[model samples]
Target chain A: MTVTSLPHDAALSARHPGELGLRESATFDRATIADIQRAAATGVYDIRGWGAKRSVPHFDDLLFLGASMSRYPLEGYRERCDTDIVLGDRHASKPLHLQTPVTIAGMSFGALSANAKEALGRGASEVGTSTTTGDGGMTPEERGQSKHLVYQYLPSRYGMNPDDLRKADAIEIVLGQGAKPGGGGMLLGQKITERVAGMRTLPVGIDQRSASRHPDWTGPDDLEIKIGELREITDWKKPIYVKVGASRPYYDTALAVKSGADVIVVDGMQGGTAATQQVFIENVGIPTLAAIPQAVQALQELGVHRKVQLIVSGGIRTGADVAKAMALGADAVAIGTAALIALGDNDPRYAAEYAALGSAAGYYDDFQDGRDPAGISTQDPELSSRLDPVAGGRRIANYLRVLTMEAQTIARACGKSHLRNLEPEDLVALTIEAAAMARVPLAGTSWIPGAR
Target chain B: MVTLIGTETPAYVPAASGATATLVDLAESTVRDLNQALHEPHVQGEWTVTNSDGKHSIAVGIDAPVSVTIEGHVGYYAAGMHQKGDVIIRGNAGVGLAENIMSGTVHVTGDASQSAAATGHGGLVVIDGNAGARCGISMKGVDIVVGGSIGHMSAFMAQAGRLVVCGDAGDALGDSIYEARIYVKGTVASLGADCVEKPMGGEHLEELGQLLAAAGRTEQPSEFKRYGSARNLYHFHVDNSTAY
Candidate 1:
């Protein structure tokens, strides 16, 4: 086989079947050939796939108007767009006061390494937003690094303590996450090292199963009592948030309000997780676009729209996505996968290495195996060393600034001084799926079947 | 009986020995003042309370060896965290009665609500009328005797405790029962998971006699039937599916 290099701008010529070619029977599909080449190089098991393949509806089908209605547009750079968010206004003496509406969602310490969590916290702090701790108890490192911290109260009760509650700026009662709505978290046995096992109070080298229900309460009234207990423990200084996956959001939000929550976090389908069953991730809950309006409507019906802030999550990737979500009535947006991307999950510099593993850039979601070439997902000492926390945090901060800027630009173009002023009327859906799910009018039409 | 007029004084100030304190002045005190007075140390004496007016969490976290008598109804968590104290309510008590008690005596003349005597350790709780669901749940070392019917899932997950009920018990009476002695005088609605009726032996009768006496009941031990763990569902096994 003869090989020759091509010019920078040269076009390739078509070759005959017999010219510089082997037997046609020896040929293979591009994917199969790539797999064979990777196996020969790495000597690992057969190549397996990761992440979602089913085409779930997303925010791409929606569009935003730019100051065409009965409103005036703000100057691009001169006008101000406030992104402040206050959580837990119902009962907290000192609510969670954030400088920006954008915050980091919960990602467990066991799932991601300690350094990665710290980097996330630091980056969020640099951008004046809050960072949350996940199922693996509150670490002092995370608390000290973040300007504001939201501690998650999960079903597993891992690392839960009264001291941590007193120390946290806010407490989020996590009923469920969007990735696996009714399912519990399962840390595979291979990832359960001595430290991870010890932090979770489980036996080493065993798959840890988190219980679905809380040990203390059963229903809404009991939830009120539990909230009282937490308040008494914290001296009512911190705010309390109730987070639920987008399954029956109306009733869940109403119950949360009755249970005396100051904030509501509604996570929808397409949220990221360290590990979850593929079936649950795909089929459990509604899309984010469908969940936001329902939750906002619930709060509005209760006359507590701004009183109880609603933060939305799941599949948020761009600044345009953030603007679209706020227009639909989310007080703020939280990100996971995009944050990981900013921290170098699929950098093109590792293209050769990813190709060697039969994968490519932007397709590296196999985080549970501890072999991430980008150094963000792996627990291996050498691979993890490739990540510099300070540098990664700066990159994430830069990305966050860009997202915030883009959101503000859209808000200004919509004749809104604040991001919150980007109302639902500014949006129209391009597809029936989006139009029905988002409760908005279809493009080039005045029809909104669900509109009142 | 100490009278509290303002929040400056603790909610409950234990009386000195041989002193009788009338709680008539406590009628006008706020909940905050009452809590503060009750949390104060070194106030131990005989106390008589009148016109409780449905106050909740009264006499909570009291560890002194004092006797408190309430003339009217009480609200939730009454006598919670009582240690070495005796509290008597002439009227009904709300949920979580005698919650998390240790080495105390709580007597309710009227019915008690759900979770009565829940998670109490080393206490004697007596209810003159019926108790609600989850009665004596997660009890560690307490001895509870109810004169009327007890609700479902009573004595659930109890560890090292004794529950004696003179009237009928609701369904799943002893669900998830563990190492606890349950005595019932009337018909049971149904047995719970890992729970079954056990034959009353002489030693169990004696134990029942002691529990009944501690609960201030004059009933004979022979009138009651004993129940305990069936020991079938303690561990997971493939073939033992019938027990669970």
Candidate 2:
């Protein structure tokens, strides 16, 4: 198509090869990228679960105020930003009190290896937070190892008992998770070994399906009865929490309160699952940014803000992210993937082995197979050994400490005395996506579209 | 003392002192008084009731080897926390009947509601009629035998035990059921997330025969079908989504 071309010297005159050359000059918008991707693909890649692999507009556009205005900055080393969180209200005789806001979310014994679960509990305990048992059932090792344990009352009622309820520091009624809202837990047959199967009380080597609804109750009123039953079982000693996915969170949060839930755990679209329908995970729930503000609004309307703690979780990766979440009105944050990372997921050291398994370091998505190199997702004896519980726990604790520190740093910069004082007014959004989702003003402007 | 006025006695009466006592309280008090009067270290007796109305948590937490009889319908958690007791309900029982029973026998003369014999450890629970959802859920060492059909997700996540249903089973039967043997007579509507239908051979038939006999149902064992795990989706494999 080109009849004539300029000399190489002339063509390269405007820029250095190292600067804005082929690599740097390559610019394509979303449409172009999509077109290229479409043309390049020979076949569809079948994958399960929620979350966007490609970069999507997230809460990154938001920034925090460092120590400046009305707030005094805490000394990074000397001064403390309190991380303790008390879940549930005064009605609960034994509320869930944690030393850190970063609690471990539920991962069933059947979905994850026993060692992995133990490591999670150990690590969370080391960090002064809580760990939760998943749908399979409560194991003595898990309950005994964790300093503070939250027992999950799932739809399937697996391993649920009054003794465990009484022993637990808190009770979490898992209405739904963000990754698979309106869906149930699924443990395929390959993962159901004798031990795993035995733990769940199913025949060894069978696919385990969890029901979508609780057997005892069908609606919100019934939920109250269930909560009452739980309270009776525990003598109203333990805090009762209701966990729901981000879909229609405002209504769900309100309903949970109506159902006498002491704490509300709001899980957003970015949350992870051991295994879920690919369509359900990615398409069913709202983003965390949108869900948080609505959840806060619901609690505020109920005049129970801060009394009924709101724990928000989904794609929380950095200290800044944690700070932003808190500023947006989350009492605390629970992390799953990041915690797994701190426990050594996608480590560069395992790059060769991951490659041998037809996966890359960061692309190791085979969590349902139980062949995890990180030892967090597998039941295999050898793979699980790759993770040392004590060492892994130490690393997680260190990471949590860093996240808390970073959050405190920003909270102080915002001129707030405590992390909770870092309000939404202290931040602005850099992108329309975040501005709308987070309900904040655009950077360098006072305009909030729906604000009165 | 409250006396029965007629042949058809009322199902229940709240205590005069306004205590939140269940039917089990009366049963326990009766047993305790009987044992104290008898002055015997232990006593074994079979008591039968002709009519049982909906009564909650009947025969709860009984430790003695005494037989309890209920003539008609009963309510939630009947025979709850039963230890070394034999509870025979002549009619249908509500949810969580014989829940968490440790080393006991619970015989239902009629159907059972949801979660029948839930989480019972070391017990024999026999339901003559249809058992609702989550029958034998999370049972540890208990053996549950249902003469009729079972609802959805029966025996869900049972850690260790055996469930024998003489009729059809609903969807997600044995979902996440672990190491528990389930035998059904009619077709299972659907296997649970990881569960699969397995061949019921001579060994399974023998085991089924024993369970049926224990439940006081010695009918033909050949009519029952077996279900178990396929062991495919235990780990986080990329290609295992089909089973999930």
Candidate 3:
């Protein structure tokens, strides 16, 4: 005497195929099937924005060992926990002294709207951290709002001038980004506004292809001379930072240091991009959790570990992520995708709008389409006005404060007075994969899977 | 007493002309001393750089409307990013000579190495002797007049500038170039992708004549063959995938 009710339409029960007794294959998953169909439908490969969506070893796998019996914890609000950091004192006369170690990574004005750029500058400035310029070059809106601006010197040299070079707080020589290390970025004609075209010195509404390699120098030997040229251009005043995508972290870091870099910025594969092939994004480069130790080892071997500052970036989100990155030997951590989320990307309020674009709220990553509902990644004047720069700046400033406070809380619990003092000894990996990647011991065991 | 004229104290002597003369001896002081002085505000004079024996970045980033003459050969990036300043290299120049020059003139009396006047926004670059590979590569708005032959891949991706090569051009000239015009008096090995030999018209002749005259060359504009972008590879297409 079982009363089974099946009153709804077939479409209403369509969410799960498992109810039909169809076993889902892990190898050829639903997402993979859709990807194959997409390639078949369109002759072009899938181009989207965002970091690696695939699961891999990351920071969440590592847990902090808070003080219990052996060490005493600092009183939550009574004892002090500092988070200040100084970057790039190796060659430059002036170095950046940040209140918090967390800085904003490079995002171009063209990739983001003017309002978004202004908001990022305002937010980073409010928290006494540095903001960076990207490929398209510096804009007046961003330069005006940012307190400490680090200008990026790329291969394209778009909108690059002597006056702008001298105006920067620090100069970063960008070799590659984390999303696609050996590949260049593409800005579709839809996003290339008149202003962007003017800055880049390209045709209006033309798709611009950024060069992968530098036009002037050839190799590291030539890079050394190029560094000297930049130093001579600014009269050795601004700090020179060399940024590389995480691949051969050990060799790349050592070469950067050898090339006379005041700082090395290693970006992992989880780093976001304005536009890139989905395959390149998912396949290329290693993870942030794995890159830090290798970079640290290289710097330490060179006897200039702390001297040459290391700023790691890719998938930094929360305070725990920040603290964990620092404990792994990063002088500082940079945020990109998380910062955009804080500034209202993929917001639930724009769920309907995202659905119209064939995406959901949290699933929207078409930064290349230039039809961003959140007003952050679009150049449309009406959509750009949707995000009030002042309001967005405040939200991000609050988020940054929370991040800093949370890191401080973790540091206090770890019995460390400073965030940098939370070393590898205070961290343990929850899984053998993370243990091997982070080079830390697995949870209760004293054995690291990879360590000899 | 060995005196570092331009490094410690700038020796400004009133020449016969209205412009003052300042001598910078690289042997006496470092290149930093010379460049630092040139970067200072209100720098207006005729400067002479002596003993610049293959020094890199000697007299780079000069913004003043002064004239700098390097008496000897120099290494990489000699007179890079100079604006309003007229830099003259008396001997052979090494890699990246006058790289990213915004305005004014860079004249090399001897052979210049790779990437001469690369990414130059404006002004004129005159090379008297044969230039190495990638001459005027990615040149933007700068008029480069080479008196002798240029090496391979010359004028590749040259944008919005006039490159007048008085001698023969090397292989793959004007590869994937945009908006720029090239006039060569001698034989080209081959044209690169998206580059073709355009008919030399009246406007081309006059412009080439002016550039040649500016570079102080006697080659008639009629003898030169004009080349430019075929406007094929400006936009990407799957049909033209093999060219890239």
All candidates: CA RMSD in angstroms? 9.3, 7.4, 3.4
Q: What is the C-alpha lDDT profile of model 3 across B19-127, one tens digit per residue?
A: 5457778889788888998998998768888999999999888888988888899999999987998988889999999988889999999999999988888889999
Off by over 4 Å in 1: A1-53, A69-71, A348-361, A369-385, B1-244
**Candidate 2 residue-wise lDDT, B85-155, digit = tens:** 67778778988787776787888888999988777767788999999988877677788899989999887
Ten contiguous residues with the weakest lDDT in model 3 chain B: B7-16
Q: Across residues B35-110, which tens digit of lDDT does each residue of candidate 1 receive?
A: 4454457755555565677766666656667777777888777777567878888899887788767777999999
Query: TM-score, each model?
Result: 0.68, 0.76, 0.95
Task: Please compute DockQ, using alpha carbons, for every candidate against the native two-chain complex.
Answer: 0.06, 0.20, 0.57
Worst 10 residues of 3 chain A by lDDT: A1-10
State the C-alpha lDDT per candidate: 0.77, 0.75, 0.89
Candidate 1 vs candidate 3, TM-score winner: 3
Give the alpha carbon lDDT tens digit for every residue of A1-452 in model 3: 12145555667466565664457779998899999999888767788888888888999999999999898899999999999999999999999999898999999989899999999999999999999999888999999999999999887777777778889999999999899888776788888899987787666776677778777898788989999999999999999999999999999999999999999999999999999999999999999999999999999999998899999999999999999999999999999999999999999999999999999999998999899999988899999999899999998888888999999999999998998888999899999999998999999999898798
Which residue pairs show collisions in model 3? none
CAPRI quality band, candidate 2? incorrect
Task: Name the candidate, 2 or 3, with the larger DockQ value.
Answer: 3
